[model samples]
Target: MKKLKKINFLAFALLVLTTLTSCKVGRFIVYNFADIKDYEKFPARKIETGPTKFHFSTTTKGKVPEELTVKDKKYPFEKYLADHKTVAFMIIQNDTIQYERYWQKYNEASIVPSFSMAKSITSILIGCAIDDKLIKSVNEPITNYIPELKKSGFDKVTIEHVLQMTSGIKFNEGYKNPFGDVATFYYGTNLRKAVSKMTLKVEPGKQFEYVSGNTQLLGMVLAKALKDKTVSSYLEEKIWKPLGMEFDASWSLDRKKDGMEKTFCCVNARARDFAKIGRLYLNKGKWEGKQIVSEDWVTQSTKIDTSNGSAWYYQYQWWLPTKTGDFMAKGILGQYIYVNPKKNLIIVRLGKSKDKVDWPELLANLGQTY
Candidate 1:
């Protein structure tokens, strides 16, 4: 009887292993959850820094608050951040580094995955594409580039529809589900094939439904528009090289060879370099008198507009946490690139997880103190 039981147990274990290995389940089982260091797990294309690096002027006597009140209880600012799984936090104002801190052994050189924050970066590229005339306009039907998706009822979908998150495309945004669309995009090796099979969940240009797939579709459209240039290469030429980034970053791809960038997420970069993205927008798309991206695009991206299926709080992939004209690029697990134009402030916080803090609110309040 004991021998028979052992044989049955072994059989079950083998069956489970086989099941996991044959699908995205195995990837999920191995990866488990997203982490800041997840850049190491995926294939990527490099974004090289420019010859000249722009540095934020730092102050010796930092003016950032040392104590923060959460839930009506006061706690040390560094302790609050450290206890809440924070890895890096930086505050920049007037092109100056006011306060910077790192915890959990993460430092200036550590590479952190951007997660959904890449969505905002993707939006920037879309704007750049328009400036380059590679893309005509946001009003153009996405089918102009991706004619294959026209059969999927994408003809009704405009580039602006996807940009505004009103595309109504069918996508499972939940990353934890192994069988979901996000998991397939994240773990599966073929993004273009998956994108080709995309379908609409509802009529386009009606309601806002934020999904990573919308950004991925934009990536596909951008790819089609570029013709010969990869999106990463365009980024290197347009933004990365011009921004004067301190470190060479990378955009994770779905595969190593003939790979499509996972443009919905996975821009792996350092904290200081990420803050430069905010600086670019803060200066209205100008870098040292050079208009990197159009000022009109910057205004359209950050302005509060609620017309034609646009969300009042979100425009072009940025989150307007309040009606204060501030916007941010947010990611899962507490990663943020917050820009406050009124205060000339930019705050970057990268972390292992959110840890239940009202981050947008905290950043807003912290900005008020400045």
Candidate 2:
């Protein structure tokens, strides 16, 4: 009788857990269980590229330092990658591929989700829109582009405010909560509706809050400003095609066919190709002697803003390093594109989960050595 009762108790607990896992909040986890396990298969919208592919020069010089020291301690590079569940680790120096390695079947051709790194890409698109004169300036009221948001408490918001994540939009960025705004943005359909429902919690540009909704709002503004052109097309023509990315990347959409992209996250591309974005910024928005994005825009976008007071200084959509001048585009689950202009180096790291390695410190240490 005792043994039977114990078995029944165990079964009951599992049944309750399963039921909880199937709820709306839990649905994202259950539905994407397979995708979470296999990142390469994450669904996304195709961002097609043109025929010409940019070729990266290869060199054997400057191998990754066997180990990187952090906080006065040394850790092996290979161990760091393995421990962090790194899928791809790449280093580029002087416009040459210095070191490249792949793990768990991911290689030069494999595409991985960029998570929030797309935020930086979206900011670049905004700069392009400004350069094209589609929008007057970053200071222009975002409502000038998206009139629909005018009455949504976004009347005072500007393009610069959204890029700086100072839109003061009241949004819960918690990923763990199933019913939170972030989960709705990430797993729920209908991004347009999701963003439209957000209300302003404070005055725009008063305080810096890193909210994905800010980027989503910016996307809506871009869509309005571009009119007939899609964000993907603008990116393709202005940056991707010109940069010569080898593979056609994709952005995950809220729905199939015509749904809006989750502009705050989800740019799926190869590690090698993602490195080009860093190199583009490192070269001050010029690609192969052509001014792809204006030098002034790149300067403003990557320049660190100390006013935010965040541990990682916030710039236009990029994260400024603790050290000055060098910057990085970071995403959830250990995705990073670290650029050091002084060293003429770019490091791309993509992983399945948060890595144990402190990349900023590692980069700072590398900055000292290389």
lDDT of each: 0.91, 0.81
What are the runs in model 2 whose C-alpha is more than 4 Å off?
1-27, 32-43, 307-312
TM-score of decoy 1: 0.93
**Model 1 per-residue lDDT tens digits across residues 163-234:** 999998999988779889999888888898899999998888789988999999999999999999999999
lDDT (tens digit, per residue) of candidate 2 on 1-370: 9999999999998997677543445556666522423333334566777788887789767576788676888889778677778889888888888889988888899878888889999989988888899889988998888777788867788888888888888999987777888888877767787877888988887888898998998898898899988887788788888898999988777766577777898888899889999999999989889988889999987776556432247789998776568888988777899988888989998888765667666765676576
Cα RMSD to native, each candidate? Answer: 3.3, 5.0
lDDT of 1: 0.91
Instruction: Please state the error at residue 138 of candidate 2 in Å.
Output: 0.6
- Candidate 2 is scored at a TM of 0.89
Screening candidate 1 with a backbone cut-off below 3 angstroms (N, C-alpha, C), the clashing residue pairs are: none
